[model samples]
Target: MQSILKQKIIGIDFSDYSIELLCIEKGFWKPKIYAYSRCILPPGVLFDGAIQYPAALSGILKKMMLSAVPNFMKNGLCVFSLPDSQVFFHEFIMPAALGGKSLRQAILHEVRTKFPMKFDDLYYDFIVSGKNHDTQNILFFAAPDYILEKYIQTLLDAGLTPIAIDVESMSIGRSLLNSRDRRKDVLIADIGSRYTNIIVYNNYEVSGIHIIKEGGEKSTNRISEQLCIPKAEAEVIKKQIGLSFHGQESEVSEIVADDMKEIIREIKKIIQYYLHRKKITIDTIVLTGGCVLSPGVQKFFQSHFWQEVEVRNPFDKLRVQKNDEKNKRNVLFSNVIGLALRGLHTYPHLRGVNLLQKARSHS
Candidate 1:
């Protein structure tokens, strides 16, 4: 493995609606943010976590690099994240007697049997959490081979070195939770433009991840339909009066409230599964991503769930350079920031889930 202690890494996240990039320098005590940028992706370029137009997307990435920071393509090591909806996650136990090649074979065999899809069609990885009496608990992650290849080829075409690829759930948990927070079981809800990712962390480890096909775009569309206004105008209205239930645009609030209730309903299903399976009760819920910027969204979640709810700020521990007002408060970059932190080895506990690690080793 390469030493990330003193390296500068560009972390990129590709969502259905936008692409986010962040450059950071890893310092001994703290990480320093160099520059960050977000570009709205053209429709049909990406859909349901699949790249429909690789060439067009790569062209946009090349332009984004040149515009964000001059000479950033030179020796720029990059890490990117996969959308949660496209990835598969499962937790299982394997006999501890298996070790070395035996353990590897056992895991592969189990995955082949338990995974719904064929093993040849996927790139899968696992993290062994720990050993219990006679078994080892493992968390598995897998993504489609074509999807991973498209992203890798896109980065290579843009003249960037791809170091690692991760999923949004792990990145969200790593960036939002502090050391103390990790010690306790918590739930993280990341509401992006097109999907909402719910992650359950037990004893500071990822236990479950679920993705719903609803997000900020759904709420905006609801507003647009209800008021017969343009999407742009509806988006503005949604942000200004989101689920507060008080204002002249209370109708907009009602629309957002309905969408939020659906999101919370899915979240509760995941919570219920965890509680029934592991007997773990999550006491805190951390909200992050672009949709969380809506007004009163946090309060709505707090009221709906008994757990303490709070919005995530990725710059809480890092020293942010002097920047404009917009960059300082941009919560949408949480996933990218987490990718950079992981690339920099900032959080030891959240390491080694990179999908590209095995490929790099074989190469």
Candidate 2:
């Protein structure tokens, strides 16, 4: 049987504020980007990870897919990501003696007991890493059934096949971590328009994830309120000035500083929790998502964290076209590129957890 990992697929990321789509040709050494595009979502289309207007979203997606890639309709296989707020993650260790059906049963029982929601209302999946003596370490995710169905139905309405679904954190991890960095402990802070997703990766597997309800949108709103300007104008100024703390932008930067500090504090808490539980220090911190486009944000993180903090570019390894404008906005596509990388299967360690088969099995 042909492995699904080897198949060519498009990757889609649905955020509260925007939708990103990427299609790439999987190569042996590096993946080549064929096309990519981003579409801003109108307000009320998606809120807190739920699709409030499925038909409207589908219509927008249909237009985006048609315009972004020439052969999107013919090659409809796609893997998509759900927002971090809609997904729940947990890690546990089960007896290595359990195998196959027994392991599945054990995991299901544990998931049902540990998670507050009933199994019937949720779709869950897991990946087992290596064993430590007699116990196998496992990372699993559960998302509400209604949300999953909404995504699947939206894709269907857009004339695309939804092959698999994953969370944003996994996609970010795949896009940011290279082979050398996979085995090292790392922290990823993905600051999007409406949410900041903090993910911890230990020894090539996701160990922890947390979603902060603050992000670039909050910063923009602060800038707007402080400058007494319209939001659209504030957005432009925010990107142009961006926490530089100098000259004309200093006042705007100061206004957004509080939110940034809160985000950093949350990151610290997540790191401390991981360190206390695992006894391993995080080797590096990778920052991605739209907020990373802020002019001095990377330096801000580096100064505060006192660790090797770097902004992630999902397209760094891919072949670049001459004067490609999309390359400059790599941070915006990090999650979608990571989802596309999941399709390439160049790095098995970075492949995301696909819940499609698990969802079907439950049905």
Candidate 3:
């Protein structure tokens, strides 16, 4: 693949439990990390993506800005990922009779009606997937006014510029697209700490994106409850054992296995529904998440789903220096790496089906 020449972009991922801040400077063959830092939230502060204590989060961002990007804090361009619950994504259609200005008007009208929040209560954007034969099809997204404003305000309040708000699923999707060609229908599942987000791309167009509440935390809690162990111990055990059933605690393993079975059933149901409704077969399943690193997860998923499966790795798109063995091994940072690529694409782009915003931004 050809190299993309561009500048640096700072990416920040804020979670209820931890905040991950990273910066990527431009490179010809590969991107270089300028800075990285992670901070855990204080206990009783916040839970799963909700800002229970804005002041606490703001303070953390403030300290992180001072420590992580001390030299160039002010006016630095940054982007943030919102919690899955606070964001909404849906597909819609407009009449074939409408084109050009008429189409634009129709889309805006649909946005006005379809969005859950009032027009004044959110910062909205969308992607035009393509025309469904004749009618225009689009994917719409809206983040609550307060959710977006809080991030912008937190940045402004701290002397950093938050230039964009995006979905984490799309950020990672861009990296996957850059590295591989998904000629057929496929599902990309990103199982994070609090939620598992699934994005279905058929022929390079995003057909569906679903966010499920089950994730790593759920597994941890299940282990904690069934094994009669502390949360921290359960967490360690989760990573070490995962779905492996290799340990002597047969009873605990059975309980964990049961929980995993439930999750798999739910995911399978979602996939089946999409396949049947859309009349598209899923050619493959790609898993990306911190959990994928857990022992035996890959084999477990392949065995249960009966489909080809793999982890997300963006190394194929980067030209690595032969001496940088450590960086070459860090495949888990694929999502953040993709988020960093946004600034270096030599063009303004939005991943997934945001054709409207892409055209609007470039114009």
Candidate 4:
């Protein structure tokens, strides 16, 4: 495929744990990493992935963006991915005859039957994937209207323009897999601060996501409780002494081992259920997020799953000129990087659906 000429855009993402920002100058081939930064938010600013204190969080975000990209106001182009909990997706078949105005009516019909909440409360969009005989398979994604409104308000207050609000799981798939990867079914384990999103990438669109309530912070807390250390110090020490205890009697090692296994178990259960009902078997396993940084985590995952497990660095594909060793090594920034890639719309990956198109036009 040919390359996109050029554009400038930034991708911003935030969780209960922190705020992340990334910018790219899309060019002939690989896009240059224009600027990037990640800043930890104050405790209690976010709870369960929702902003508990919008004004203060907005201030923190503004300061971080200013320091990283001083000229952000000039272009102000960006995409934001909200916390995964607020974003929901489902796949359903639509008859080919309902391809026009009736398609919207069909979607609304599915919404009324599937979603407990009223249709008026949702902000939704759909992307058609493939046609089977007279039917079409489309992925539907929606987030609460109030959730989008509050977050978009915060972005505006932070002095940025958001062109699209994205689905987190799709962002993860786009960042790791490209056109070549479209031939295989890839399973991605995106372990975040408080949740691990298990995403299944079928040929084109994201097949499904199963959010496990286990993540980096949770493991740190367990280590602190078992080792009698402060949570801050526990985080540092957990990274220092990972799953490879190598036949030691250390309780810290035992605690860490159990936590890792539990996460793996949950993921396996989800995969088994999918296998029973589908023809696709997982082709590869990709691990992302800070939680997977524990020394032997990737090795342990491979041992249990008996597959090729890799810690993916999204920057490896981009044309980054600067010597930002930290950015190249960190996997936590995959979501934002994918967001920026979608903003460019150059890559061979499917043009993932955006939830913010309506909101952007209204603004």
Candidate 5:
């Protein structure tokens, strides 16, 4: 029997609250999304991008194989995203002469000596971002080793081959940037349940990331706490009334706005500093994750920053394999879609790193 490997790739993005899957099968034409599934994860399964309960997560993954994914795609090779909140990204300049073993040795030593965290505890990867007369820009990323192991075990238990692990910011960059025109410098504001990642991508490669302490969920929590409403009800109210208002004052909008002010402040600071230092302006602001679906969020960003803002829609350009696929999709799958794209290795311009380098081998 021929195992489903190279031809089909599954990209998975799972957070504390949900799991999204996309399987793209490459053929002669554009990559076709053969199967896709999304399901809500139970509370306590993942806490802040780290798996809290491995056995339960494995069980949930197994259920997806039986129910969400198609029978043929249940055992294919897959790539996953490491959430932005858990990974640290840094860009450094190395001698243009360094290559092969010497480059690796230099990067290894750099990480060992510079970063505050212990090198042994991290699963890391790097890619050369660009080059100049004497220096090559190297982008380095690392995440907790135990967290990656948990994810690998869960995927394996669900019968999927885990090929590589990627950082959330790079995955977002891959999906959002067009393969043909990679010239745009983008500022991605990925607002998640607990944090918002302010990522800078120059020419389709991630250059920097800034993490805001609280994010979209904080707004929902504020509404729930102040109004004395249930969380479920609060989420619905926040989404419905998100930063939009008429001539009169809206209580829900006010509450949401009040909570979002801190995040916006931090965002402005990052954007200002980046532009000032680099003397390069961002072409667009792409909004993704939990906050994007809310009404007027995209407009709010544009009005505040005076820049082009797009509410993330990972499926906007791709050709869906099935008509039913549209109904099952959302903005949150941008990271996973990029992970699948990474496995395909189609785009000539995009640069990414694979953290799972010797832990698992694939043909």
Candidate 6:
């Protein structure tokens, strides 16, 4: 008998204190989510994006799988994300004369020499973002192989399989571009627990990506430490009060304002750099992930940057069942949703990289 084909794709979002899983099967346009699970990490299990308690995480994953998806379990390929801090992204210009085979060879050679770590020590990918008069601009991304291997092992220990590894920023970009028009340049900002990632796409290709060392969790930590309150309570206040409150003066508000200033400063620098390099103003700033949900976050950008900033809804143009409306509104699940949507044709060029790897292995 012919072996059963595995078409389902799973996405795991291992955040600071929670592990989220979104499993989906390809439909006509968007993916149909088959299973979704979120497990909060035990106290002291993980802190500030570091794995302080691997055993706890593994236990959580195992229990979640048993409870969430029982019958279809198989190793089950999953698309995993790497923290913004653990990865490096750079864009460089390639000689315009190097086209086709020559261009491919040059990129492979450069990846080996320019990377701080040995080629085998890191998983690297490159995207060509069109050519200038004498050079072709390319975006290069590298992440430690060991870090990714550990995540893969974590899944394995929990009886799951990791099939693809992607940068969180790119995954967010995938979801945004998939729902919106692809003909325009866009920027996607993924606000995670402790860090925010910015990815700029020109013509649907990654042109630039950067990570800033601030996010919702930082705001919560600052408030908790300054006010001497519990973390849970601080988080609640941060999300509820947000940055727009006009009453109740305290040190926590000052700290939050400082953090916002730093975040906005870096964002302006990155946006300016993109404008200079691309010679085109960004069409839209799409915010996703957990942090952007806070009240006035969109207003913060609008008042400061003078650009049209819109919160990204992964299901904005997609269809889902009536029961899934609430789940569909969670922007924090955008990366996982996009990862699952990889099974669709929305990201065909990304698939080309896998084929290129195969050809290299044969050669």
Instruction: Give the winner by lDDT.
Output: 2
Candidate-wise lDDT, in order: 0.78, 0.79, 0.66, 0.75, 0.75, 0.68
Task: Give the higher-TM-score candidate: 2 or 5.
Answer: 2
Clash counts for the predictions, in order: 0, 0, 4, 0, 0, 0
Model 2 Cα displacement at 220 (Å)? Answer: 2.1
Taking all chains together, each candidate's TM-score versus the true structure is 0.90, 0.91, 0.84, 0.89, 0.89, 0.85
lDDT of 2 at 299: 87
By lDDT, highest first, what's the ranking? 2, 1, 5, 4, 6, 3
lDDT of 4 by residue, 161-227 (tens): 6667778887877788867667887889988767888898778557777888887777789888877
The candidate with the higher TM-score, 1 or 4, is 1
- Candidate 2 lands at a TM-score of 0.91
Model 6 worst lDDT run, 10 consecutive residues: 354-363
**Ten contiguous residues with the weakest lDDT in model 1:** 354-363
Candidate 4: regions farther than 4 A off:
1-7, 69-75, 247-250, 321-323, 346-351, 358-363
RMSD of 1: 3.1
For the record, the alpha-carbon RMSD of candidate 6 to the native fold, in angstroms, is: 3.7
Q: Please write out the lDDT profile of model 1 over residues 107-135, one tens digit for every residue.
A: 77787787567767777777777677898
Clashing pairs in 6: none
Model 2, CA-based lDDT: 0.79
Cα miss at 260, model 4 (Å)? 1.8
Query: What ranking of all candidate models by TM-score puts the best one first?
Result: 2, 1, 5, 4, 6, 3
Instruction: lDDT winner between 1 and 3, please give it.
Output: 1
